[model samples]
Target: FKLSLLQIAEVQTQTYLEWKEVHPPQLPKDAVPVFDKKSKQTLYVARLEDCTPCFYDSAKKSCSVSTFHGEFNLGHTVQNRKISFLLNKDNFEIFEWKKSSFGEVPPLPVETCNGYFIARNDFGLGYITDNSLITIGAKKQDTTENEVLTLNHDIKGQHLTITEYQIGSAKASENIAELKHFTASNKNCEAAKQQVKLDQGIDKTVSFLKTRTHTFGGTGETSVSGKVPLIISIGGKLGLKYDYSRLNSKTTSTVEKSLHSVSMEVQVPANHACSIVINSNTFTADVPFTGQLTRVYNNGEARRTLTDGIYSHQEVAEIQALVNPCTPLVDKKRC
Candidate 1:
């Protein structure tokens, strides 16, 4: 006899509730219950059954059924079910078979089931019931030391992967003999040699500045004598010389002088030679050497004097014009 819509729904509901009592819904711990729109209630699938006889395989002891029912006026209808039992075992596990169809199946009463249910239809789309357990052959306890098993589900691809891992007790050691041989075969690369040269330059610069002396020479009847100690500041600037003197043989009198100087900053890198402002008058030729004074101003002088080869006469005039008496040199608008 054909069942009415109301009668069919009632039977489905009754069957669902009965099966739900035996196997409570085993949803994901994070799963929130979804309410059915028609029933205005949250429902879980307890069990699924096929009314028609299923295809059976005696050798495999499995049965499967694929059924299609419904009217075009009512809607599309496709139903598939399969079940397998391990009869030999006392508490035999049951497996549900799913078959795909050309058209969509009518909405079943249960959307989810607590136990394992695997459904595959004619369509590539398939679903695996949550927390399903599948066991083949006899089960045995894992006794191997540090053995681990991992299961991962590919929700998009609808597949499951199982991996096993085990830890080994063997110890690992470096090959000291091979390492020594490899180290002996290696020589200092070009870059390493350059770095060593730079280090030597820096050391030499420090020593040179510490012992540096300045001497003045002129063909005039005056002898410029008396040592001027060269001072190198931490920032690599040449500090001012104080109380410098030029001795004259004719008068036997010494002219005292003090001067302010500006020099360029130099930097050395491991990959390249030292870099310095070569265009500046304070250019120093020695590696790691403090630059020579590009410009010098004698004490009480209004304008500084540029050393030869550093600044042209026009450049010097421009620099002098940029210096304003009313404002600090750094704040001058033209600077």
Candidate 2:
């Protein structure tokens, strides 16, 4: 069965309420404590004022409020399935009752008590008028009056307790390697200055659309992996050409490994548009390739817009290039 949004919300609400029943949440208490090893110390004293929540940071070993609300000896004693608070009787049944003969009936009033003591921890037993030392049961369900905990007896005291405490770990340091530059164009400007090897007998025409700043070392390759419409300019007329690499295995295999090296003759257009023509296949459609390029212009006054569209992860693998540092001259107006 399908559940509505409201039904999903109710399921979450019921789960939270069920969890809160036995597992009383840790109240924020910032009570600073003064421990005395030589003498007995009253860890906490609860009253009407102690009803307010407290904030404590155990890692810092510091607290904000002045009173510990019975957390020291009875922190983990509370569970989730035992909430037993009473509803306020005065606010109960605020809705009216309507009768067929008399229209509306008068509300009934009577003295009522609704507050109930909860047994999640030993808070109810420790509320004494006289200032006296009290201890809670360790495992056995015993509620005696004003019991004093002792190390000599096999009570909760002197038992090894596993607690979560905070410890100072680390701080970050400056990186040693330099950062690379990014650009709008598909190619790096400075990288155009480096030489690319063309297979001895192959005649290749390569072009770049945009220039980016990058580091000095890396390998480069190109390949086509999809079906797209190919057009050619013949006799000053644009003509449509069909690329059948998808249907024929021999044609697709040969085109996939064909080498068309990048050259300096081809410049990236001002708006970062780039297109290359290989013998029979036209490369206006998107193809994924990883290569290296260097920073072209680092002049302070030089500014150009990038024109490459970011592709989806399923469309292509991210290209990695070894990038070098390209620091431009500082400008008095802006750097």
Candidate 3:
């Protein structure tokens, strides 16, 4: 059966727990997170690293085959993981498995046109078998609904990975997309929600879509790292709003682009702090659509300038909502 991203995530989490006792990650100092509104019962914090993302592993459990953009490579060790097997973008072709020295192959190649190469040695050790000659999308997979197939291979070790050879990739891996993680609310605590604004004025922040992680040491200093994490909390549920009047620049639009209210229940990870960040391209009011559950980081330094982007009526309202903890919470939007 095919697995969705969330399903894959569950498997990853289960795998992590099984291995947690064997190899626990030393949480970084700046990896700690702070709550938007501190409370005795429940606090929301962000995380930096995706403890588990989907990747392919060999049947022998020796090495894995993974795709990075148009290029592919063997996710063997940290050193080779960074290098791409297919660097030239112009050569974006795909490959097929004719025959392997390892054993009888599954009919996946017939169903799905392309996937990683696998090689096995006499010792039963498997490495990413090579097929460097083919370009990424050169050959398309069989489009027939029955073309999709799943196979389980026992090469050597006790490890296993579900490889989707020919099926088209999912949208969750798309650029400029939204990713969300929802956790159960803390027991008996009032639910937390907020409206996030995007900083559209700043091209850099929008371009980079910064990724951040906040690590808090036992000390008071909340050491934030990565791009600046855009973290905030609001009194109500999270939603999107627009001001079309300001679309022309001189004045604000009374009619907003189409405000969307998302009534989502958020549940954070246990014993894990969340993170936040502001990429260089992110501007005043642009809210993040991707990786909602992922944590970002903040510098914690006071803003030198109130930021001109915040002067806009729409942005001002969002800002007030974010910093409401300090004051009685006044509505800043005149419209």
Candidate 4:
């Protein structure tokens, strides 16, 4: 009986993350304001911790996402199954939510709050594989509705997320490792799960927005992916990866960012459900959504210079679409 969504993503990526598995297009129309174009994709990631790709299970929550692997479903319900955070932030109090503790969730506290760090604890968004500096967002749901989730990461990694569904807090204890104390209701969602756990020391990749699931009955099927870790270019090594040995100084201490695009709008209120899948596009849920999805990977215009370093390239770069995501955002914008 309550669903409010406002997704704003402005990621202008230039480049990383090449682990692929895409397939999400089931539209009967519950919500769709998609804007697609600028197609030229090429991905190929071979190793992300011995190939785990993406898979999550926090007592079986569902909100969809695939990258590196595991945990992040703040929506689903038949009876016992729920999880959520984020209580306020009407525009940069920094987008509210950050009060502390439920089972420990942390990542992104300060990196300018642009956000980009996706892996660890399998629920902490730790590594953020780096797909040419990616940022993708689009959220809309309905299984009835009642969802709430929020994420913000920084340690200089940049990862801000929000998926508002409902239920804000309370109820999600059917063995989520035994609910470390998340039953008392909202404390800024326990401070947004403790800032998603200290902003990534990173363990396995798990952390999200939407909670309610015992077995994805709400259908927000997720395996959370977008690994993309396979970039090698050397010639003098001032560190590694992309360096004709530095012809003009961009430094390179693991430089990745620039080419951003993120737009997330998730809301649930009624029954409850959640789901979010990027790099593979999938936001299908029965219900459970809060709202918030901010992805900003900035390193500055696709950092890769080789004026003469002998040159080398080729892995993935094939997608010449006119506009696809369903392509709808016309008239005033043209998609």
- Report every candidate's CA lDDT: 0.19, 0.20, 0.20, 0.20
Off by over 4 Å in 4: 1-43, 46-163, 168-290, 295-335
In candidate 3, where is summed lDDT lowest over 10 consecutive residues? 8-17
- Please estimate how well model 2 matches the true structure, expressed as its whole-model Cα lDDT: 0.20
Off by over 4 Å in 1: 1-34, 49-102, 105-164, 168-335
**lDDT (tens digit, per residue) of candidate 1 on 147-246:** 1111111111110011211112111121111100000011212322111111101011101011111111111121112222222221112432322222
Tell me how many clashing residue pairs each candidate has: 6, 28, 60, 111
Q: Which ten residues in a row have the lowest lDDT in candidate 4?
A: 1-10
Instruction: Score every model by TM-score.
Output: 0.13, 0.12, 0.14, 0.14
Tell me, what's the RMSD of every candidate?
A: 39.3, 29.7, 27.5, 32.5
Q: What digit string (tens of lDDT, one per residue) describes model 3 on residues 1-335?
A: 11111000111110000111111222222221111111211111111122211112222212122233433322332222221111111211112223332233444221111343222222121212132222122221112111111222111111111121111211111112222332222222233343334323211101111122211111111111122221222211122231111112111112213232223222333322222222221112222222111111232222110001111111111111112112212322222
Question: Poorest 10 consecutive residues of model 2 by lDDT?
Answer: 7-16
- Model 1 TM: 0.13
Query: Candidate 2, residues 103-150: lDDT per residue as tens digits?
Result: 111122110112111111233222211232222323222333322211
Please list the residue runs of candidate 2 whose C-alpha ends up more than 4 Å from where it truly belongs after superposition. 1-49, 52-192, 195-335
Model 4 residue 244 CA deviation in Å: 43
Which regions of candidate 3 deviate over 4 angstroms?
A: 1-84, 87-113, 123-335
Better of 2 and 3 by lDDT: 2
